[model samples]
Target: MRVAIVTVGDELLAGDTVNTNAAWLGERLTERGVGVERVVTLPDRVGDIARVVNEYRAEYDAVLVTGGLGPTHDDLTMDGVAAAFGREVVESEEALEWLAEAGGYTADDLAEGTADIPRGARMLKNPEGVAPGCVIGSVYVLPGVPAEMKAMFETVAEEFSGEVEHVASVVADEPESALIDRIDELRDRFDVTVGSYPGDSVRVKIQGGEAEAEAAAAWLRERVDLKETGE
Candidate 1:
């Protein structure tokens, strides 16, 4: 499965808050063998949110958005998401019922603001909090709080599944240029996508079948070495 992540928060864009959700979600997705194609953090602006939402929703198989979900002025995620799909917002009965069970909220409390989801969206149950998320098409609206967002994601367990086995490894002691031909060779040999991420070390992600991954692993062990000079 290929997925895109949208982290919505002024705090994150302004660098006041670390984007732990992005990293955490990416790690979880990776361990699940899903490929995260992109991750972006946007300030709480309708135009920005809508642009990103529409773009990613069309580009990737799945879109996951986190933050701006509470009953606060800054929480314009639902509105932006609605605009992205050109849909109206309405209170979700499923969310209303779920909220009542979680916090004893009256219908009034559950009828406004937080419970307002994009029309025709599927409500994603948030067992950790009262505000429920919704999945419209491939777009997912999740809570900002990591704990709550994770719970909401679990509610849609069947949607995000990875069919391919993938793995990554680090190699240093040589320039990344050294791996250019090696990467191409591996791609042709295993029908895998090998990406070279440069930094203090070179992180090569090998994504393909289990047999191909094993083949790539054995090939690398025999031909690749890491001495940490620079790669």
Candidate 2:
């Protein structure tokens, strides 16, 4: 499975808030065998978020959108999704009840449209906060707050699970330049991606199915004195 992650927040762009959501999602997605093709960080602009979400949904199998679901004015991720799909924003009864139960605030006490989402969107419960997330089409709209987003994501993470990727790595004392041709050969022969990183030692990462990665590893070991990095 291929996915794109969109993190929305002015604070993240300004460096006031660290953009840990993208990295966390990327790692988790990779662990589930889903390749993250792109990660985008956008300000709380509805049109821009909508455009990206629309584009990514068509380009990738899934689009994981984080941030901008709040009671504040800057919270516009939901609006963006609505715009992208041309769906109307309506109060979500399920979300209203969740908000009331989670925050101990009545629907009337909360800000107007606080529990609203695009029509026909599936409301995703937020175990950690009052504002729940929503899934409008392929785009999963999540909260900007890390704690809430993490909690909300767990409720829907299984939907993204896919085949497990087999990854193996090796480290050689030689520089990456010395292995450029070898890496290309491995890619062609094993049909696996080979990444060469230069440092005090060169680290080559081989990724594909289990058998392919193992074959690539064996090929490298025979050609160069390489130490196994890990599984």
- TM per candidate comes to 0.83, 0.90
Model 2, 1-231: lDDT tens digits are 899999999999999989999999998898888889999999999899989999999999999999988778898888899999998888999888777777788977988878889999999998887777899778898888888888888999899978887989888878777887888888879978878887878888898889989889988978886655567
Q: Candidate 1, after superposition: displacement of residue 76 in Å?
A: 0.1
Clashing pairs in 1: none
The TM-score, computed over Cα atoms with residue i paired to residue i, of candidate 2 is 0.90
In terms of lDDT, the best-performing candidate is 2
Cα miss at 90, model 2 (Å)?
2.1
For candidate 1, lDDT tens digit of each residue in 135-195? Answer: 9989989998889988877777567778646665646556788877877777778877777
Once superposed on the true structure, which residue ranges of model 2 sit more than 4 Å away at CA? 225-231
- Candidates in order have lDDT scores of 0.82, 0.87
